[model samples]
Target: MDPLTLGSIVAIVTVGVLFSGISVAAGLLVVSGGFLIVFEGFSALSLMPEIFFGKLNNFALLSIPMFIIMGAAIASTRAGADLYEALERWLTRVPGGLVVSNLGACALFSAMSGSSPATCAAIGKMGIPEMRKRGYPDAVAAGSIAAGGTLGILIPPSVTMIVYGIATETSIGRLFLAGVVPGLMLVGLFMLWSLYSTWKSGDANVLRATTYSWRERFEILPRVIPFIAIILGVLYAMYGGIATPSETAAVGALLCLVIAMVIYKLWSPTKIWEVLRDSTKESVMILFIIGAAGVFSYMLSSLFITQSIAEWIGSLDVNRWVLMAMVNLFLLVAGFFLPPVAVILMAAPILLPIIITAGFDPIWFAVVLTINMEIGLISPPVGLNLYVINGIAPDIKLKTILVGSLPYVACMVVAIILLCLFPGLALWLPDMVMGPEL
Candidate 1:
């Protein structure tokens, strides 16, 4: 069989197996892409040794596990609960204050953890109960957590950005820097949307309105300061050239561990073991996907699919903005069906070349892509965040979560448009911190 035909078969089968609820890693290695690569008239076993072994040896990939460990450590310690309490106290005086604070806390936690489910699990556990007790509707509570969880990718120390940087050979630290403004923008938009919803629905009184003395407000700072310190310290070290991205991640992990031990005092031996075990499991799952994706990507490249697709896109006479909008539309539709990680692994390689050819900055594209993926997490049917939040609060209908997420999704669309119209919103920090590319 022709290599193109074999490649197409592998791609289809792999995607089918995944969509059929089988493990993509297992599908890639055992039944689809890898198997095809091995048997497709190359030296059978030896020709694709690099696919089997070399791809998994990426040193930068080590950061995935370390970051996961760091996130799990902080999560298991319930540090996020404390952060939420502090934020609630500070924001409770405002309309829809609890929901806004939930968004804020999720964004902050996202900066440290870089995993959406972790953000949801950590914040949902506390945020849901608090909102519930405060008389917020289940849909509102679930929707807020689900939407806020999407911040995990847009914020810094994001695992998604790390994967993007590694895939595209872009600097992870620069990508991290690039995400800061846009991430905050998304948080602000979510907060505003929350406020608007509260106003329209007359739900402003759900949270107990309490005014704190300046001194009392200051006291809550002690609980929040550690998170701020960790975020600032990691960014400062990376921006100041004191540490590499991987090293910064390691330091962040260690700092989180120490904070859990000393300040939170929730780190027991059994708890530590649980964190390690869970992190390892999640890390292994991600790494396996990464390795398999590398293999599948190699197969696609070998078949000239990426090049052909890029050339086809380049030949189009459409306006660049139109083409770009089409790409966003495609991703938004795809997000409804595909997991964010899987979408990134498959689509980034294809779309990235077209983006570069159109003279778009890869860093800006990364942020845009991140936001689009976030949209997918709230889109119906397979929205991961909705399911996660629903798991935490099962009584809420999925339709309710879906409907509640629509306004936030509009906010994301607006954010994407703003970044598109002003690429500097995403690129400025990276260029300033990383220096303009020579």
Candidate 2:
């Protein structure tokens, strides 16, 4: 069979298997193995183990587990609640401040955790119920939290970015730096839509009767500020030439544990064990996906599917913007079914060369791709964040959650456009601090 025809079959079969409810790692391995045996012969199967092991051998991947530990530690504590409360106290006077604060909390927690579901669970647990109690619509209450949670992958210390960096052999530090401005831009976009939504619905007036004394507002800082400081410290360590991404993650993980212990008194052996266990489980899952993705990539290359596709794309007479639009559409669909990590692992390698050849900055495209994954977290069929919000408020219909998240989806698309129009939104910080990539 021709490579193009075989590639289409593989793509369709892969999607079918994923939607069939098998795990992503299993799906990728099964599809890759099956295709290789059927097409490349049994001898090609021998390299599977070697290929998988080689993918996981990278030193940069060390950051993933450490960052997961940091997220798990903070998620296990009251940090989410404290962060939300602190923001609420300060923003209470602002219209739609309650929901706005949830978006802020999601962005901040995302910076700390770098996991969307964790961000949603952490903040949605408190934010959703509070918004509903304050008379916000179920859609707005559930949707805002769901959409905001996606910031996890776009913010610094992001696990998705790490996977992308490792897969494409890009600098993880530069990828992290590139994410900062785009992350902030998405946060601002979410916030602006939040403010407008609340005003239009008159939900802004909902908080009019709620007020906090300055002391009350300031009181929550001790609990929240430490985490924010840790986030800042991690960013500084990465951008300041003080440490590699892996080293910064390790130190940041330790600080997260220490502070969670000191402030939240989360020092019990069971609690500590839980943190480690969760971290291990998440880390192993992500690593397995990376390994499977490696075999998948190898299979495609051996079959000439990857090269054929890249050559076809490069041969296009369309403008770079058109190529970007095509890439973005593909990513958005891929994200709807696969987790961000899996998507990055499988797609980044195939797309990176094409992106660079087209004269776009890889760092900038990384930010754009991360934002596309953000939309998928709240989208349907495989919308992990939406389900997390559902878990937080089971009473809210999934439809309502989906409805509420729609605006934020639009916000993300807008952010992507803004980035495309001004690539500097993602490139400026990284270039300024790290000196532009040669």
Candidate 3:
């Protein structure tokens, strides 16, 4: 059989088997990757060594474990709970104030945790019950927590950015720096939407009319200062060239550990062990996916599928904006059924080259792709965040959370358009800070 047909068969089978949920990880890896090797013979098997070793030897990949450890440690601590209390007092005066405060709290926690599920679990445990008790609708309460959860990927110390940087060989430090402004922008958009929805619906009953004195507001600073310090230390060290992105992550992890132990008093030897164990498991899963994706991508390239696709795209004479709109449509649909990491791993190889050939900056494109992926997290049929929020609030229907996420999805669509129309919104900061090295 021809190599192209063999490669196409391997690709289709791999995707089909994985999505089918019948094969376990080891089985899928061996079956999908092994079949390609067996059919293609020893020369193709040689690529496995490169793919395996190349993924394992990456120094930047170290950040994955460290950041995961940091997020897990912080989530296990009481600091996150305290941060919520502090934010609630300050933000509760406005309409849908509690919901808005939930977004604010999640954004702050996400900057430290950098994992959406962790952010949702941590905040949902606290915020969901509080909102329900205060007469907020279930959909509103669940939706806000779910929407706020996505801020994890946008904020600093983001695991997704780390993965993207490692995959594309872009500067992780610059990606982290680039994400800050856009992350904050998304948070602001969510807040405005929450406020408007609440005001129009007159759902102000959930907000308690509480006032915080200057001293009280300042006192809560002690609880939040550690998280801020962790974020700043990571970004500052990276920005000042004192540390590589991986080293900065290591530093952040250690700082998070120390703070959890001394400042927050939540660390025990067993707790530390647990955090490490869990982080290792998660890291291994991600690394396995990366390795498999590398093999899959290699097969596609060797078979010339990527080249063929790129050429096909290049032949098209559509307006650039229309092309972008089409890309968004494709991603939005893909996100409904596929996991974000899988989507990135599979699509980045094909679409990224087309995007670059079309004169779009990869850094800017990363921002756009991330926003699109964020929509995937909340979109129906397989929306991961909706399921997570539902898991937390079992009494709330999935439909409620899905309906609530629509407005935020609309917000994400607007964000994409803004980034497309004015690429500078995403590009300018990175350019200024990284100095035009694209």
Candidate 4:
């Protein structure tokens, strides 16, 4: 079979298998091995060692576990619940008061967790019930938390951002910093949409919103201030030249432990062990996926499929803006079917070259891509966050969750466009904070 035809076949088979409910790692292994059968065959079996072990040898990857530990530690404590309460205190007067608080809690927890599903599970456990109690339409309450939780990956300390950085060889620190503005911008977009939808649907009028006095608002600060400290300290330390990304992760992990143990008073061995075990489990799964995708990416490179794909894109000679738009659109659609991290692994190798060749800022594009993945988490059928919210929100239909989150998807799309139009929105903070990229 011709190379193009052969590549197409393998790609389709892998995607089809994914939709058929196979693990991504397993699907990629089968696809990569299948690609070799058509070309390199048994001779390339030797590449297995390099594929699995070599991909994970870097010091940078250590941050995955540290960050995971940090997230798990915070989740194990009352941080998520405290964050929601604190936000609720402050945002009660907003149009979609409870909904806005839900988003706010997700955003704050996103700083600690850097994971969408974790954020969803943690915040939605509290946010959804509170919103429902406040007379929020079940769909809006469910959707607000479901969609808001995606902020975990778009905000700093994000595991997926680290993956993208490693995949693209961009600086993880810069990428983390780049996401700051875009992440906040997305929070605003989501809150604005929540306001609009709540007002439009007239749900805002009936919902209960407690107007908090300044003294009452001050009472909740202690519960949430420690979290803000951890986030700022870790990011600023990394970006202000006090720590490397790995070191920042370590500091964040340590702070998270302190918060969980001393602050939250969960000094028991069982709780500590559980948090570590959970962290280890998540770390192993993500790292294994990374290693697996590495092998698959290597196979694509060895076959020169990535080169061929890049050349083909270049040959189209489309305007760069047009290509960027097409890429974002493709990512948006791809989010419907593929999880964001998997899409990044496959597309980064194949498309990053084309994007870099066009002289677009990769870090900027990284934020853009992360936001696309954010939308995917809430999107349908396979949206991990949707299931997460559903699990937490009993009696809430998946259909309602999906329908309610559709407006937030528009927020993400708008974020992508604004980032594209003003790459500075993503780049400026990283540039100012970290200076010129090395």
Highest lDDT model number: 2
Better of 1 and 4 by lDDT: 4
Q: What lDDT tens digits, residue by residue, belong to model 2 across residues 320-373?
A: 989999999999999898888888988888898899999998888999999899
How close to the true structure is residue 335 of candidate 4, measured as C-alpha lDDT?
86
Write model 3 residue lDDT over 275-379, tens digit each, in one string: 888888888887777777676677677666678767877899998788888888988877787766766776787888899888888788878888888888888
| Model 2 regions more than 4 Å off | 203-207
Error (Å) of candidate 1 at residue 15 is: 2.8
Q: Which of candidates 2 and 3 reaches a greater lDDT? A: 2
Task: Give the least accurate 10-residue stretch of model 4, judged by summed lDDT.
Answer: 200-209
TM-scores, all models, native as reference: 0.93, 0.98, 0.93, 0.96
Clashing pairs in 2: none
Write the residue-wise lDDT of candidate 4 on 50-149 in tens digits: 7778888889999989999999998888889988888888878877778888888899898889878888898889988877887777888888888888
- For candidate 2, the 10 contiguous residues with the lowest summed lDDT are 201-210
* Alpha carbon RMSD to native, model 1: 2.3
Ranking by TM-score: 2, 4, 3, 1
lDDT of each: 0.82, 0.91, 0.80, 0.85
Q: Which tens-of-lDDT digit does each residue in 114-137 have in candidate 1? A: 889889988999999888888888
Best by TM-score: 2
Runs of candidate 4 with Cα error greater than 4 angstroms are 201-207
